[model samples]
Target chain A: MEFTLISLLNGVTYGLLLFMLCGGLTLIFSMMGILNFAHASFYMLGAYLAFQLSAWLGFWPAFFLAPPLVGVAGALVERYGLRRAHRHGHVAELLFTFGLSFLAVEMVQLVWGKAVVDYRVPPSLEGTLFTLYSTSFPVYKGFMMLVSVGMLALLAALLAYTRTGLIIKAALSRPDMMQALGHDVPRIFTLVFAGGAALAGLAGVIGGNAFVTEPGMAAAVGPIVFVVVVVGGLGSLLGAFVASLLIGILQTFMVGWDYSIIDVARLFGMQLHSTSALTRLSLTQLAPIMPYLLMVAILIFRPRGLMGARS
Target chain B: MLEVNGLHAFYGKSHVLHGVTLEVGRGEIVSLLGRNGAGRSTALKAIMGLARAEGSVKFKGEEIAGMKPHQIAWRGLGYVPEDRAVFPDLTVRQNLLLGVKDPKAPGRFRLEEMFALFPRLEERALVPGGVLSGGEQQMLTLCRTMMGNPDLVLVDEPTEGLAPLTVAQVAQFLLEIQKRGVSILLVEQKLAIALDISQRLYVLGHGRVVFGGTPAALRENAAVRKEWLEV
Candidate 1:
């Protein structure tokens, strides 16, 4: 039971990290109508930048500086890359982002080399918070939770209260109408793309230390983030939040469970353990597939996902 | 205030507008009257550079033949699309707020003034636009456009698919806007409503302007209406 609870918290933390990355991705996709494959790459860049900055400054300052730097990179890409590719239609835009992701991953390797960089938790937040039975949660993880909550609150407030936020909200609903209403929609798109990248970057600053910071980390994290967004539903923030938490808890609990199909079958008195390839597969190996399985089920049952409505 | 000379607009390979020329003076309400498929909406779109077009368009004595839709809008011209493009997820108050254009704006509309203009909208200011009836959505679209305080407004088929009472209300709203000295380019199918509100009329058919004159002249000329507008 303690094991389960510990793993559940572990899953929630990871899920929150994914949410940080995916929330920006959802906003970008809705506002720009481009599936930005480079989004994960940006997250990776954030980690690398934070790692580099943390060596000079501290972890907290690196956290502040890295996101905006990544945001500037995102703004430049919008001005040059995405905007140029936008003239070629949705497929072209997707391809452009896909190519950019490929390039960014390769660039990371070229600059940082192939090995994983040691991204340690800041000394200030390096200890345990408290013990429960035999398990203790790390102080750094508690700090991560605090930071994520603070970021979410800041974003929610900005989106809800500011004029620019109002424009973004309006644009997300009706982009052409936004254009007609005399808002410089291209400028708005640039801002949204940058803002999204900044969020991803911020996620990277925290998540990089929590997870492993490597050139190939994007490949590992990217598909899961996509699954989170798709499971959450496109163009819906509330859906994203729900899916994030759901996936988090699901992943956490699944990892802790030690039961197998064969064991369950034996318990139920259906002990037909013929040597099939399916039965040979370990429950440990199935952990990675859980989110994808859930994604497929969601897709089959509800085509627009949990919150999306076909218009 | 606006002039289109030899305007040519195309949709893919099939041409929708061909060599159309028209003009609207300052503070005048000009109506483009035609039956469906007569390129009435296309003309407004073409002039606004919303459609793929090739021709000469002049506004305020400056040639604006090949500008983007937003650029055209930024030049003090606003378009209300035929479908009444209201942001369904937004509240009525938010919708109105979205239309204010000035970069350094200072409370463009007193909420009371707008409420006085459309009491129904005021009553449901916080309601999401999707829940509103078709008539209310149309009013919202118009009110939203006027909120920008534009120099010239391009309104496409404002009376389409509305109840007669709502149509009358929209007409009154247009007149009120005109009273505020805003020039209007109205693309409409209902000839009666078009004639009621417009100072001049242009009838289009097969991507060309078949007739252009006053409402009285258009009413008297049976051949023009029969050829271009009558079903």
Candidate 2:
């Protein structure tokens, strides 16, 4: 019971982090029709920037400053780089972002070195928030949950209540119509790209210290983020949220279970098992690949994803 | 007022509008009548900056030929596309809200006024635009454009695929729009409705204006209609 409760809390915290990344990625995809392969790279940039800023100015200042800086970088990228590639079509845009991800890694390595950076949670949030039987939940994790949920509420309100939000929702489906309605479509595109990058940066600031701040951190989390977006559905923010939580919880629970396939089969009254590696594989060993399996299943069964409007 | 002189629009290498010339005077409804490929829609697109075009497009005496679509729109031009392009995921109210250019500065049209004009829109204000019936979508599109409070509007095929009763409602809506002092450059296929609503009519043939005159003058000339407008 203790294990389940602790794992559930950890899973939700992790899921919220993934939600931060997925929200921006899905929004960018819906608006620009580009998957933004460099989204995770922006997250990495956020972490490195936060690490540097925190060293000089402390965590609170770094927390506020890093995301906007990343946003400016994103705006510049859209205005100068992505906009030019956009005219050449989707493939060119894809390749441009794909190349950008590599460039970001290289830049980070050149400036910050390939080794891991020491980025720790703030002293205020260093201790445990609560004890669950024998297990303890860290205050930092609670802070992370607070920030993520706060962001989600803020985003929802902005999209639902504001005029800019209405225009963005309209532009998501009909950019041409939006332009005809006196909206500067290109400017909106730049703003959205910047906003998306900023969200990713915020995620990086929070997640980097929670996990590990390193050059390989983006790559490590990148594929799983994509899996969440795909398994949720393209361009559906709610889908991304749900998928993030689902995958996060599933993977966390799987990692906690040490039982092998043969042991499960034995419990089901099928004790005889072969010496094959698949039959003996533990759930903990399979946890890392579980998201991929879910993605594959979703693709085969519901190609449009959990809430995708189109196939 | 809007003016298009010697307008030539192209889709890639294929020229769609060749030297199409037309005008919409202040507080007037001018109809562009033509068959499907006669460039009626392209003329409107060129005027709205939706198509690649070369020539002079003057809006309220300002030369806006090379401007982007949104720039042209800022010059007080509203466009109602042929496809009834409503943001399907957005609520009807949100769709209308998007049309307002400056939310802080009130336009000539109001949300309340739109609801009054089409009570059906008020009934489905909170509903997603995709689920609205075809006539409701058309009404929403028309009202959405009006929310911008444009000085001159380019309305393309607003009555296409609508029921006869809805068709009458659209014609009535156009006249009502004119009553509120908004000039209209209407692109329409239905001859009777266009003849009824328009102050002047321009018949387009093979990307050029073949006839331009009052509705009475068009009624007197059957040859022009047979050559250009008759499908």
Candidate 3:
């Protein structure tokens, strides 16, 4: 029971982190119509950048500085790379982004190399927050939760209240109409792309100390973020949030469970196990693949996803 | 005031508009009448810079042959597309707010004045644009363009797929706008409404202007109508 409860909290933390990254991807895709394949690379860059900055200025100042630097980099990529590939249609844009991810990963490897950087949390937030049945939650994670909540509140207000936010929401629904109404839509696209990168960078600042900060971090995190976006539905931020939490919790719980399909078969009194892959499966082995299974099922049953409105 | 001379537009090398020339004086209502595929809409699109074209287009005595759609819109030119482009996810009031070009400074049109003109929009002001009926959507599109306080409007097929009573309402609306000193270059199909509202008429046929005259002259010229406009 203690293991289950601790894992649930862990799952929520992981899910919120995913939401931070996933939210930006949704905004950029809906407004700009490019599935930005290099988003996690930005996250990886954020982690490295923040790690380096933290050594000089401490975590808080690095946290403040890293996202904007990443945002500027994202803007330049949009101006010089993605915008240039736009004339050839969506496929070319995707290829450009795909190429960009490789370049970002390689650049990180060149700068930081293969060793995992020791990105420790600030001593101020390094202690445990609370204890439950001999299990303890770290203050760094608690701080992460607080930041995630703050981000969600900020995002909600921006989308609902501000003029720029209103225009972005309006543009997501009708881009041509936005352009026809005298709005500089390409500029809006650049802003959105930069904003998304900034968000991923923020996530990296916190996630760097939590997870291993290395060149391979983006490759590990990128595919799962794509799953969250897909399962959440295309062009829908709310769906991404819900999907992120659900996948996060499910993956966490799956990792905790010791048995799998073979155990369930034994409960049903079925003893016919003749070297089949399904019978040999363990929940430990199944944890990583559960999100993909859910994605496939959602695609087969409801292709629009839980909260998706795209027709 | 606007003038077009020898305008030729192409949709990826398949010529859609050929040597179309027309003019509109300030506060005047000029109607471009034709059947489908006759390039009546194309003329408006080319002038709005929504289509690729090469020609001499003079507005306010300055040549504006090539400009982006947003640039034209910013320069006091308004275009209401045939599809009635409304942001469906936005509230009707929000839609109206988007039409306000200079949000910092007041313009010729006010929200209350627009509501007074169309009480139905006011009643459904908080509702999302997608839920509005076809006629309401049409009214929203027109009112939205007018919210920019444009000097000239390129209205495409204002009376298409509308009831006769609603058609009269739209015509009244256009006249009201004209009374406000806004020039109109209208693309309309129903010959009766076009004749009733327009100060001048240009009939297009096969990407060319086949006739240009007053409503009375157009009524008398049965050959032009039979060749260019009549189904």
Give lDDT: candidate 1, residue A275: 84
lDDT of 2 by residue, A173-275 (tens): 8999999999999999899889989989999999999889888988898899899889999999999999999998988999999999999889999985599
Docking class of 2: high
Chain B TM-score in candidate 3, rounded to 2 decimals? 0.98
DockQ of each: 0.74, 0.91, 0.69
Error of model 1, residue A113, in angstroms: 0.9
Instruction: Order the candidate numbers by DockQ, best to worst.
Output: 2, 1, 3
How badly does each model clash, as a count of residue pairs?
0, 0, 0
Best by TM-score: 2
Tens digit of per-residue lDDT, candidate 1, span A197-244: 998988889989888899888888888888887888886777887798
What lDDT, from 0 to 1, does candidate 1 have? 0.86
- Measured against the true chain A, the candidates' chain A TM-scores are 0.94, 0.98, 0.95
The candidate 2 chain A region of ten consecutive residues with least summed lDDT is A264-273
- State the lDDT of candidate 3 residue by residue for B109-158, as single tens digits: 88898899999999999999999988888999999988888899999997
Instruction: Decide which is better by lDDT, 1 or 3.
Output: 3
Instruction: Tell how far residue A101 is off in model 2, in angstroms.
Output: 0.6
